[model samples]
Target: MARVDLNDYVYVNARVRGMRSHLLTRDFFMRLVEADGFEALHALLEQTIYRREANEAFLLNPVRPDYDQALTLNLIAAFRKILDAVGGEPRRLVATLLSRYDVQNIKSVLRGKHGDATASEITNILVPVGSLRLEQLEVLAGQREIRDVINTMHAQQIKYARPLIDAYPDFTKKDHDLAVLELALDKYFYRDAIGQLKGKGTNTEMVRQMLVGEVDMRNISTLVRIRGVRLDDGEVENLRIPGGALSADEFLHLDRLGDIVRIVSDYPDPRYRKVLQKALAEYQEVDLVAFDRELEHEMTRRGAAMSNLDVLSIGVIIGFMWQKNNEVINLRILLRGKAMDRPQAQIRSDLFFVEREEGQAA
Candidate 1:
């Protein structure tokens, strides 16, 4: 187990609070639209949240590669700073989130292989922020087959690699294997890491409850998508990740989606059902992206609510992290929208505002 000095919360929270003030707001997104191109975008970013990364990133060309490289470097640097501030076990705990980069790298490698992309092209797209270093990710990408990466992972005692190895035999092509491997890795990694954490005596249970709720929402989304694709019950079940708040019995009962509505309604927290109802209503007509965004916004609001409590625990840390990540994501969305010349309404629709009421309800 990684060592944790619980008393360090004072220093940790102070640093997080200071950093939180720098996050971009709705006003920032409004200003980003008028920027000309990548260069102007780069300038704006440098002036705002990414001053440090942008400065370092400018050492190279301001092309797409440099922009992405700087962004990735900036992200890892910020994440590591938080870890260092917290130190000890919290570092290891927060590090679990970076493990998602392994899944991201797997998807990128498979996509590149499918498209017959050059190693240079693939390397540029890969975001390095995981337990595995960039060199390690590059090595995996250069391997002749998935087994090479699996073998490397096995040698390293990466517990999450087993599912991918088991599913590899079923994969004849890159797309299927990447999808299956990614979904499996997400479940295995999060479950193992969250299960290890001591969540007692704090809003830990509340936050854990929120994570479990997210699993349920994700499961719902998966079911809807798979059903639309005309997949069979068995295939769908095989694809589903377990350990959500939903019971096996409840999930099995979801032969029809009305069961999902009922199940969500029965959740102990009333606001979840209220939000789900509104989101699902929109989802029935439009695409699920809106609903997905709503769910995330709701969860962020829930985390923010927990952060407001005077208690010292993982709640504020987790809440602040979500807010920070949201800031990054919202900026990316805004930048992409500006690049593509999307209308403000369309871009605004995609933004999920954290509601104080939703947080309080959580």
Candidate 2:
């Protein structure tokens, strides 16, 4: 009873809290955003915890600044450190959550292979924070044929390979559509993740809540993406992820959506309804920046609230992970914005920051 009261992830949370403390403040991001150029950005990054890897990244890619690669490498290293620190239930919970990255890694490989991108280019974009190690993904990325990639995964007994194999028939039928493989990977990940999360513990509940929100966000994004596209109902049916706050019926409503405002009006959660309102107001055809940015902010805010709630449980870990992710996102935007000579105002507009009060970390 005492340990239960203290929570399953008590010790892990302490370490995570320390890690979260190192997260950059909004003021730091402001300075980074306004930095003169890649040289100025490198000088500033050298002062932070990313200093070592950032320097290493620059040395490895001396011909280019490679801020994108530096930031991604740092993010991957941070997540791997946490995963290395824990065991038992805490480990399982964290690993399952991070499996989303596995989905991302696979999708990047498939897309790269389908699009004829070189292995190095594909490897540059991967973070390898999930079951798939960076080396494993690099090898997969090197495969000349998409079929070779899938076959290699099955040969190596990768857990995610089966669904991709099942989905490949559809891919061949549909003119090598990568979306089919991507959506199948998503469905497999959520099903497996949610299954692993089945329990009544506080940690399980909060993490499941986060998963639900993710499912809802992905479902809505899918609806929005396929709205004007030439996709069929069968295609849309496979896109709705199970285990979200929004119901299947609600998804059906969103799919038939004609009035743009109805998307904002119809969503059940007023929190996300407001977010949709913002996205809707700025909604442009095919450009997902406004929508993706707003939705990501809402998710980060949710993570922040959860982090504040369960000091000894999985909430803090999940929340900090998202914050760490936001750190990378913000840095990437700042780096790219400065590199491109985008205005300070424009770069600031693109960032999704945590809301802090009374000098507290969000």
Candidate 3:
């Protein structure tokens, strides 16, 4: 871990706080859901942080064929701006967090290659926000096979290539199971990110807590999704990552439980119990999408509280990053829902927002 100067974080923290002000509120998202079509949504986006990217995307694809491309570009650009806003250890820390996007891009390319997707189609899903540049990703995306993609990454000495390389043989032998490959990448990412924060000063605890919270949530969600599947306990254990709040034994026990909602509701962590109950009720009434939205909101809400308590530390930046990412996700949901003519109420229900206490501004 690198030494972080708390004083140095002052400027960046201020900048992040200012940027947080620009994040879309719940009200704004409701308005987006009320939007009649993609054109209206695009117009609404012009009034937000996506103004530039939205314009560029419209210029390139006048028919607005795929809004995901524009959204991905916008998110990448926003992350780059965040990278540029800091220096020294903070920059390195933020870059480390952003590297998850590199992992995501690599996974996308591997999957695309597995499916024999065209370069243009693969590029649409790539988010070029990490150390890897768009050109490098494009080159990798052109690989004819999954092995070639992994080999190229390894040959280039990319940090994320190791796990992919190690998991490649098994993935190939197992009928090219993409889940195996994806699990490898996810495990490696959490391990590496958590390992990097071992000795970082001041901000280490906040970042570690954030990472742990995310891992726990992901493990729970994975367990829920695979409940009725044919996977055995060993396979389920493989999907759970270490370094989360729960121990391996505890997670295994939770996995064996018949009621996921009751398991979460009765868990030691009270922070999420209420949210999980709400999500569970919605799940029973509607579907998993509603439950997912509530769970995400709980996480973001907790992150916001941590950030508020440690405004002078990396918590603020982490909180802002989460909010920014959620904004992009909510916008994508609106665009997709409107495009598909899904009910406005359903779209609005599926969106996650950073919950605010009464009298608190966004």
State each model's C-alpha RMSD to the native: 4.5, 3.2, 3.6
- The 10-residue segment of model 1 with minimum total lDDT is 353-362
Candidate 3 lDDT by residue in tens digits, 234-345: 8778889887877777777777775767576656567767776787887888887766766777678767776666667788788788878888888888888887889888
lDDT per model, in order?
0.65, 0.81, 0.79
Candidate 1 clash total? Answer: 0
Stretches of candidate 1 above 4 Å error? 1-7, 36-42, 55-59, 62-66, 125-128, 173-177, 203-207, 228-233, 258-271, 355-362
Give each model's clash number: 0, 0, 0
TM-score of every prediction relative to native: 0.82, 0.91, 0.89
Per-residue lDDT tens digits for candidate 1, residues 281-330, read 77766866776777777777766666677535555566677776676677
- Predicted candidate 2 versus true structure: per-residue lDDT over 1-362, tens digit per residue: 44432225767777788888889989988888767767887788898978987888788786675778778888888888878777878888888888889888998899899889999999999989888888889889989999999999999899999999999999999999788898788888888888888779888888888888888888877777667556566655667987777777777677777455666687777767777877776676435667766777788888877787757778888888888898888887777777778889998987877775454553
1 or 3, greater by TM-score: 3
Candidate 3: the clashing residue pairs are none
Candidate 1 lDDT score at position 29:
64
lDDT ranking, best first:
2, 3, 1
